[model samples]
Each structure stands twice: as C-alpha cells, then as structure tokens.
Target: MQNMGGIFGILGVGCGLYIFYALYKLKSTGDITSSILLPKDVNPKTCKDKDGYIKAVAPKMAILGISTIIYGLMDLCETFVMSTGNFFWIVLVLVFVVLIWFSVTVSKLNKTYF
Candidate 1:
C-alpha cells in the first residue's frame, strides 16, 4: 500500500512535467502534429487555425497535467500521513473526475476547431 503511493507520485509527477514540456515545445515550434492526450484521429492538418487550436488545447491539457500531479501528491499523502480509507477513495474519484472533465473538454474543442 505504501509502495503504491510512492509509485503513483513518481509516475504522476513525471507525466505532468512531460506534459508541460511538450506543450511548451508545441507552442514554441507551432507544431501541432502530435499530442500526448489528444486522439490520433484529431488531424492537425484539418484544424481551421493551427495556432488557435493549440492555444485552446494547451491550457486544458495543462490543467489535466496539474490535476494529475495533485492526485499523485494526494496518494503520497495517503501513504505518509492519511489513513488508507476515505482519503484514498476521495483522491481516486477526484482523479477520475478530472480525467473525464478533460476528455469532455477536449472533445468539445475538437468539434469546434477540427
């Protein structure tokens, strides 16, 4: 149980950092050909305005990444300070909510732009 928290924390923080770096590169380079969160079927070439689309999506993804790190931190808290009951379930549910919210938001963006 304790080990799981450490693993979740490390992986979540790493993924969040990677998301930030990728968004930076994407925005800096005007390269929207790929995305870590977006579906591959979301053709960048089909976007009405490439820069506009990137601007819209980057923030959403950044939010998701930040929430992921938060979830990870919550897991770490469970491992260290909190007990393994309500806090754990709460964090898990929150993470899933964040993920679903992100997904819905991105889908809306896709429909608007692509």
Candidate 2:
C-alpha cells in the first residue's frame, strides 16, 4: 500500500542520479558521437555545433533530473509523512508537466542543432 511509494521514490532518485551522471559524462568528455539525446533521424555527424547543442540541452536535462528527484521526495513523503490527498495529485501533475517540457525541449534542441 503506502509503503510501496517508498520503493518508487528510491527508484526515482536512482534514475535521476543516473541521468545526472550521464550528463556529466557528456559534458566532461564532449562526446556527442553516441548520445541518447540525439534523435533517431537526426544524425550527430550533421550537427552544426556539437558543443553548442550540448550546452543548450544539458541544462534541460539537469532540470528534468532535479524534478525527478523532487518527485521522488514527494512520493516518499506521501508514503510516510502525509496522507494520499491533495499533495499526491499536485505532485503527479507536476511530474507530467516536467516530462512533457523535457520531451518538447529536447525535440526542439534536436531540430535546432541537428
């Protein structure tokens, strides 16, 4: 029941950290040759400026990672501290908004640089 939420929260945090780590690697290595951020049809070889693209997209990914961590904390709170009421719905909506924003921004970045 409510305890299940703790598991999900931990998983979310793990995922967020992993994403953050990936971005760090991309930034440090400047390796755009094989990036998950690149779209399927958008070839990295055709990118106008790989560094510029990463600079633009990395912040967006960071935002997404931070949002996921926040969502995870909220979920954990819902499981242990508070009851499943208004807060749950609000967090759910916020998660959706962040996800949609991330997707749209990434697509736009792909078009802008790739």
Alpha-carbon local distance difference test for all models: 0.76, 0.79
- Tell me the RMSD of model 2 versus the true structure: 2.5
Query: If scored against the real structure, what TM-score would every candidate get?
Result: 0.76, 0.80
Tell me which residue pairs clash in candidate 2.
Answer: none
Against the hidden true structure, what lDDT does model 1 obtain? 0.76
- lDDT (tens digit, per residue) of candidate 1 on 32-83: 6356645777766777877778888888878878877877777777777766
Instruction: Give model 2's TM-score versus the native structure.
Output: 0.80
Q: Could you give candidate 2's per-residue lDDT for residues 19-39 as a string of tens digits?
A: 788788879986663444775
Off by over 4 Å in 1: 3-5, 80-88
Instruction: Compare the candidates by lDDT and give the number of the best one.
Output: 2
lDDT for 36 (candidate 2):
49
